[model samples]
Target: MNNPPSGGAGPDLSVTIAGIRFRNPVIAASGTFGYGREYQGLLDVSALGGICTKGLTLRPRPGNTGNRIHETPSGILNSIGLENPGIPAFLEKELPALRELGPVVIANLSGADPEEYAEGARILGASSIDMIELNISCPNVKAGGMAFGLDPEMAASVVGPVRRAAGGKPLMVKLSPNAPDLAAVARACVDAGADALSLVNTFKAMAIDIYRRKPVFDMVSAGLSGPAIRPIALRMVWELGNALELPLIGVGGIAGPEDALEFLLAGAAAVQVGSATFAHPAAMLETIRGIRDYMEKGAFLTVGELSIRQKSPRARDRSGNTGSPPQGG
Candidate 1:
C-alpha cells in the first residue's frame, strides 16, 4: 500500500519569537500544556514550536478552592489560581522530559511579589529552557495576579526585576486584556527591559451557579478564555503590534488554525493555543497543519512572508476607525 502523506503540502510555518526560531508557529499556552509530558503518548511533542510550561511559583500552590472551572457558551472560565508543583520540582522533573521534546521550552513564571518573580526568573535563568514568560496577567487570583499587569508602574516594577534575573534568556512579559490601556502597559514593560511581549492573558469574568445562587466557583470571579475572547485578543495584538517596536506572542482564545492565522495576520510573531487544548488535545498540531495549508493555498512561501497588511484609507473609512473604543461600550 502507498504511504500516507507525512507533512502538509503547504507553505513553511517556521517562525521566530524574540530571536528564538521555531520550526512552526504553534506553541502551547502556559498552564494549558502541563509541562509537555501529558501529551507525549498522544502526539509528537517535537512538532510544536515550543511549550510554555504551567505557570510556576517559588513555592508550590494547591490552587483555588472547589469548582475551578465552568463551561460557557463558546469558552471556559477558570480560577486555577496559578497552581503548580513550583519551580524547583519542575526543574528536577519536568525540565528533563521537556528537553527531549526538541523544540524550545519557555518557562512561564508567576509569583505573589516582585522579589519572588525575580527569584523564579533567576532560578530558571540557569536552566536549559529557551525563554521565560512572566505571567503578570493571570486574573484568577486575589493578589499579585492581574494587580501587577493592570497598573503601568506596577507592571514595570514586576517585570524590571525579572528582566534582570533572566540572564541571557529572552523575557516575555504577558499582558492582561483587563488593562485600561494595553499599549501603555506594553510600553512600560518594554521600558523595564522586557525582551518581548505577549498580549491578552485572559478577560476577567464570572459565571453564576443558578442552583446555589452564587458564583460558579468559590471565587466570585475567574479568567474567561476560548473562542469568545479571540476578537478582543486579535484587536489587542493588532494595537500593540502596530504601536510597539518589540516582538509579540499572540494569545487568548485561539481555538484552531484559522484563529492562529488571524493572529499572525494581525502581526503576532507566533500564536499560543490555550483553552482549545482542553477540548481538543491535538488542536495545536491541527492548527499548524491548517496554517501551512492556508499559506500554500494563498501562495505565501513562509510565515514570515506574511505581513500585517494595513487597510487602505478608503477601506479604513468604510470600516470606521482603527483605534480601540472605550471599554464597556
Candidate 2:
C-alpha cells in the first residue's frame, strides 16, 4: 500500500490538482495536521495526497487566550486564533523537513489586510512549497473586523493582490460558509485569478457554558466542524460543482471513507480530513484505502468517474448550464 498499487492489482487513487499530482485524494486539513512532522510517528504521512500547513500570518501570534476549544454534539468548536510561527520561521525551520515527507506541500496563508496577504504570498511564492491556500477567514482589520471572505468585493480585493504577489504559483482560496452568497464569492475568486478552490472552511458557530452562563470561548463565537457539518458541506460542493468549472477540494466534517466518498461523488477533486484525526490518528490513511477498495469494487478506473455528474450531468444543472473551460485539476 506504500506505493500506489501496481496496474491491474488495484484501482488508481491518484488525483491531480492545479497540475500537481497526488498519490490519493485524501489530504490532511490545515490546523489539524500541524506541519506534517507531528503525525510522523502516528501514520504514513507520505501516503496522503497533500498537507495544508497550519495557518501562517505575517508575524508570530500569541493566539487567543482563555478556553480556546470546546466539545459539542457531534462536533467541536474552536477559536485558536491562527497562532503560528509566521512565514520566515516556516521557510527556515519547518518546510525543509516537511518537503522530505513526499506529499504535496500547501502553505495555508492568512492575513488581516491585502498587503499582508500579498507580502506573505510573495515570500511563499519565492520558496519551495508546492501550493498556497489562502485562508480568507481572517478578520479584515481595516473593514471593522469583518472577514475578507464574507463579501465578494472584499474577497476579490485581497485575492487580486495576493494572486499577483503569489507569482503565478497554484493559488487556492479557502471559502467560508458564512458568506451570504457563496456562489458570488467563488465567482469573484475565479475572476480574480484563483486556480482552484477548497470550500466551507468552517461554519460560524458558538457554544454555551451553562454553569457559568456565558460563552464557552473567549471570542464568543468559534468554528464548528466534524461529522455534524458533513451534510451541508457536501451540498455546497455539489452546488459549486454544477455552477463552476474549476476543481474544488471539499472539506468540513469528513471523518471516514464513507464521508470522503460522499464528497468525491458530489464532485470534489479531493477531500480533507480535519477533527477526525484528533480522535483517530490514522483516519486519513483509512480513508485512502477505503476509497481504493470502493473504486476497485465498482471497477472505476479514475476518481472522476465516481462523480454523480458523470452519470447524470443534466441532473445537477436544471438550467443545462456550465461555466468557463475547466482548469486546474
TM-scores of all models? 0.90, 0.91
Off by over 4 Å in 1: 1-10, 310-329
Badly placed stretches (over 4 Å) of model 2 are 1-8, 138-146, 310-329
Clashing pairs in 1: none
Residue 143 accuracy (lDDT) in model 2? 26
Angstrom error at residue 89, model 1: 0.6
Query: Mind sharing the TM-score for model 1?
Result: 0.90
**Can you give the lDDT of residue 206 in candidate 2?**
84
lDDT of 2 by residue, 1-329 (tens): 23332335666677778778788899999999999999888887887899999999888877888787788899988888888999999999999999999999999998878998899999999999999999886431222123889899999998999999989689999998888989999999999988889987878888888899998877888888898999999999999988887789999899889999999888888999999999998888888888888887787877766776644333322112231222222
Worst 10 residues of 2 by lDDT: 318-327
Relative to the unseen true structure, what is the C-alpha lDDT of residue 322 in candidate 1, on a scale of 0 to 100? 30
